[model samples]
Target chain A: MFSMTIIAILMVVVMFVGLYLKSSPVLQEKSFWQLLSSSEWKPMKGEFGFLPFVAGTLWVTLISILIALPVSLLTAVYITEYAKPYIKRLVFPILDILAALPSVIFGVWGVLVIVPWISQHVAPHFMDFSTGYTVFAAGIVLGVMVIPLLVSLFIEVFSSVSTDLRECSLSLGATRWQTVRKVIFRQTFSGIIAATVLAVSRAMGETIAVLMVCGCVIGIPTGILDPCYPIPALIANNYGEMLSMPMYEAALMFAALILFVVVLFFNLLSRIILYRLEKRLG
Target chain B: MRISKSKKISEEIAKVCMCLAMLIVFGFVFSVLWTIFSKGMKAMSWDMVSKLPGGGFYIGKEGGFLNAIVGSLYIVGASTLIGLLISIPVVFFLNVYLKKGSKVAYLARLAFDVLFGVPSIVYGAFGFTIMIFFGLRTSLLGGIIVITLLIIPIFIRTMDEATRNFPRDILDASFALGATRLETLKVVLRQIAPGIATATLLSVGRAIGDAASVMFTAGYTDSIPTSLSQPAATLPLAVFFQLQSPIPEVVDRAYAAALVLTVIVLALSITGRFITNRFSKNKV
Candidate 1:
């Protein structure tokens, strides 16, 4: 059993080493830094600069976080401090089930409902693009996909802010809103931070839903309305044709490695903070 | 008087703002579900489940997704079985053999956490990488391996949470009986059997619903996979592929597939609720 755990742990190392070796062929052809910086990706011309995908990934993730954070925070606050018992009973389960809804379902919903609506109603008023498949659309979909995660984690965090602290704040002439804003939020700062970090990590790697709406255009998005290709979407869309094109597999592998590292770093950051606090308490 | 009134006003304002935000969140959830249900259920007929796609199925003719239904069941079932075999032992070692907060145990958990955050599409990419090196093509085996890898962290975490709740006195009681460490584990596992069941169902929900990890590896076929080496279809992939078809009938069928997928997942969640409730009573 102990050896099995070691093997399971070694699986992570295996993934890292395997990704490096697989991607090294491409890295040798083009320096890793160049791949990170260059934006062009024409498989037919054999020019495989993956900067656009990386940038798209970052842009969508950033946008989604910006859109999701405030709503999720406030929702968490309401659920924790204000929701009626019946509402809590209803809302939490919906969020939990929503979290588990297949991403492809979200993709289907996005393609059928959001795309047409955005393209028809919202796009005509805005800019050059009238298609619903924009970076902003993808970001909004991703934000929706991640809301359950943020709300659930934040609720746990807020609930753990000791009742004594809440009482003390309210007794000192603080309103319910002020008590939450000043006392609970401050006390649960680490938890909120961890939830946000984890949510960001989750959003960065979102593929199916993003793929359905992001238009899969392999260029850096100048504006949110412009279409873009995220790293995960790039890999999913291009992997099927990998055999027909040389260096395609390596290129996709490199993109996957970057996503792996970025998400890993954030997860580690959140884990370290929470783990340290856990140790301190004991 | 003025200050108190202002403070009360702000409280009222904050309450209204939060209430609106909650409403917005619920709006998204409700809309997503409503869209799927309304659009999806329209084309969801008995034939969609009972029959297999025929020659004109892609061209908007009458047929079913039995192939994908069986294939998804096969892939998710086999991979989950494998995942459980591996995850059970590893989680047991973490909680039983190691000291609390031991560096090795912490490293194991950390490794799982990192792996958990690696997106499923990346897992597909990684799985495809190894498959190519080994001179393997897209096959059910590939999807199984990748998916099992993808869900292992989830299984480990779920089971680990359950094992953590195992009472120390249970171990002591076993020790007092001259029971060995292995014996203690058996007893400990039984106490947390409900957690094991919940974890199994939850991971099942995850494994069945995911499309990306299996996208490249599980080379799609219109027929059910007969062996590990054979290509298999999955419901999520069916929904994706069918939705992309230009034909309206095929597109509606995609919604039907989505309905099937959603129903299965929601059912698993309900089962999870029942299992947790059933087990919560037994908690020490």
Candidate 2:
């Protein structure tokens, strides 16, 4: 049993090492900074500039975080701090159902509904013609995908604020909204930050759904309407065909490594904050 | 008077905002469920589930996704079994063998937390690298191995949360009697049976729904895999691959596949709720 615990700890290191080893050829070919900063990505030509994909990932994740944060925070607050008990009970199952739906399903839905809607209605309002498959569309769908996760995590965080605090605030002439704003939000502020960080990490690494909607193009997206490729999408779309090119696998592996390290860093930061929060709350 | 009136109005406004947020979320959920059910039900048929992808299936021909259904069940079943074997002891060790607040336990929990966040795509790349190193082709076995890795952290974390809530006095009482540590561990396991059920539920949902991790590792096939070494298909991949087809019928078939996957997940979640409720009632 003790050995098993040790193995669990080592597994993280092993994964990092394995990915690094596989990606070393690409790293040796060009500097890590060069790979990240350049925009060119012709695999057959052996030019592996990852800037476009990195920028795409940031764009989609940022838009998603922007879209999800407010709605989730507000909804979670309403559920835990404002809504009646029965409402909480009814809403939770729906969230779980939404969460359980596969990413591919979300992708399919985006393809069927969002892409066409944007191409027809939203894009026409602003531009002459646009395919609905853009970072904006991916962001909207990803935002919806992350809502259940954010709301659930936020609910847990809000629940950690004791009932006594709410009562105390209310007794001091604070309205329900004021109590929530001043007491509940203030109390769970760090936890909310942690939850957001975790969600951002998730959005950054999410594949397939984003791949289906983001148009999977090669260039950096200059606008929300433009097609873009994300790192995870790049890795997923190209891995099988990458064998034909000499360093293609290595390049994809390096993209994975970058994603792994970035997400790992955020998760570690959030976990530490959450651990401290848990201990303090306890 | 003006300040207090303004405060009261602001409170009402805030309440309205929160309710609007709730409405928006509920709206999205309703739309997704409606879209999938309405679209998928139209395409759903007996042949979709019962028959294999016949010739020219992708080109709007007569065939179903039996390959993906059987392949999904095969991969998810074996992966869940393997993941449970690896995660159970580690969860038990974390909750039972280690002292509370121990540095090792803390580090292990942190590691699992990070692992839980690592994307499935990373797991796919890592698995692909290992498969290449061994000169192995993508097969059901590869899918099983990678998914086990992908889900172990989920299993451990869910079970660990349950185990952490377990009463320590129960362990001391068991030990005060004639029970050995192993026997006491069994006692602890029974106490947290609901947690185990919940863990299984979550891991199974994740494993079955996952496509990216197995995308490169599983190597999709048109026929069900008869051997561990053979490539297999899965429902999520089926939805994704079929949707890519230019043909409208094939795309509708993608909805059918999504419906199947969604139904399986919904059924699992409901069954899991029932099992957990049943187990939890037995607890003191």
Candidate 3:
């Protein structure tokens, strides 16, 4: 009972603080809105707008999801319906290991290897690509970072489809491909969509790796080859320095609030999907 | 019988595709490991392991990672202990004390789910604001508190599973022997000590590897913390900070640190699996 009370008190306190920060007068000032809407984000010149950061975040996240979803889904399908048991075991462990790898490691790898390789070999190939730290490079790295998660979710959903359905299709003289397309894929479509949304959600919130590779430019990205700055990257790059600037701190809080809403939406969507799957299966 | 040739062809194609997919996944794993090994190996000398990063070209020559290593152990250990200590009681209360459909237990489960999904960075931001309010800024204690928050949900879920799976007949038999509820729990349920220990260890693994939550709340300090209130660095943060440098040596050390961190997580995960497997077999 005592511990329960403590937890309740802590929760209330946390919730109150979060709400208070969200509604703070400084955060409500018209100047804050003006600053956020302004195109100029030169903190040195005392101008800061969040438009470019928002654009950068959307650009990287969209590209990442686009690249990751198909590859991860194909990998999931291969594992669930085609791979032998021995191969499944090997692939699953590798996926789990990849999932467990720290974001910092990915960041270091991105900077040390990926960024340099792109700068030297890949960037010049694209028109208007003056720098290697483009949205495309960061998107590819982010895609790789999120692939394991999408693959696992897809596998779980695909595997949940009953074997009897597959057998029924097969017994009808359908090919294995036909069985997958006509039976398993149709049954697991909602799950696949849920997994894809969740993957995109994860891509949006990803920080350290994206921050390292995205060039942290404040300008809007005109193309995939242009430098970008994501919201998480902005928070990470500016949070330490923002301690001395109250307005910047407010901006960081604002960015965090936006991020929180995005994450919460994804979490809600995932939970709803999980609940539906459970109810359908039960 | 007439469709056998088409079936065989499709199966063959499927097998080939499966092989290709597995090879691609394995290729990614091999590449990551190879990159770490090739870059990290150069910084893996005994002195590097024994010393911290220092002056120019002093990749790992100032002081040993003894501090971060010990801090990591201490923070994770303390958090795991606190999390298990808090969760086991909650689990027992729900399973043994509370009536079915109790609001508190239901709320507890929901809260745990929310906690599980809350991103680590949000936790960091929340912890930073709250800890600073409580005058616990940049302290090892703050780090422990943040880690405790991160692991509590995991332990509660795991222990809930463990306790729920404990045979009801054993509890009944203990009660029939004139033992009270608390006595029955202490005597009968204590037998699952290994499973509980394994859950705690798994929580430890998570706490140890968590970098984002600890980054802001437990601001990095190079020196060893003299008190729970002092700032300190862990291996994860060390890698983060080192990777920011432009120096080749520091960068190399970062990869070496990554390699070390990965090994630790892998060890803990393997041990947890072993324990869970043993327990399942024993149950059977």
User: Which pairs, if any, clash in model 2?
Assistant: none
TM-score of 2: 0.98
> What is candidate 2's lDDT per residue for B1-284, written digit by digit as tens?
23388789999898888999999989988888788999999999999999999998888999899999999888889889988888888888887788888999999999998999999999999999888888889999999989999999999998998889898899899989989889998898788888988999889999999999999999899998999999999999999998898899999999999999988998887777667757777786
User: Could you give the DockQ of candidate 1?
Assistant: 0.73
Q: If scored against the real structure, what TM-score would every candidate get? A: 0.96, 0.98, 0.87
In candidate 1, what fraction of native interface contacts survive?
0.78
Name the candidate, 1 or 3, with the larger TM-score value. Answer: 1
- Candidate that scores best on lDDT: 2
Question: What Cα-based lDDT does every candidate model obtain?
Answer: 0.87, 0.90, 0.73
- The candidate, 2 or 3, that scores higher on TM-score is 2
CA deviation > 4 Å runs, candidate 2 = B1-3, B276-282
Q: Write candidate 1's Cα lDDT for A77-191 as tens digits.
A: 9989988999987786778688889899999888877888889888888875677898888888999899988998888677767778889887788899999989888777887
Chain B: TM-scores of all predictions: 0.95, 0.96, 0.87
Q: Write the per-residue lDDT of candidate 2 for residues A169-276, one digit (tens) a residue.
A: 888888888898898888778999999999999999899899999999888899999988999999999877988775998899999999999999999998898888
Question: What local lDDT does model 3 show for residue A232?
Answer: 81
> Candidate 3, which segments miss by more than 4 Å at Cα?
A1-23, A31-38, A43-48, A128-131, B1-18, B52-62, B91-110, B157-202
Candidates ranked by TM-score: 2, 1, 3
| Better DockQ candidate (1, 2) | 2
Choose 1 or 3, whichever is better by DockQ: 1
On a 0 to 100 scale, what is the lDDT of residue A77 in model 3?
83
User: Using TM-score as the measure, which candidate wins?
Assistant: 2
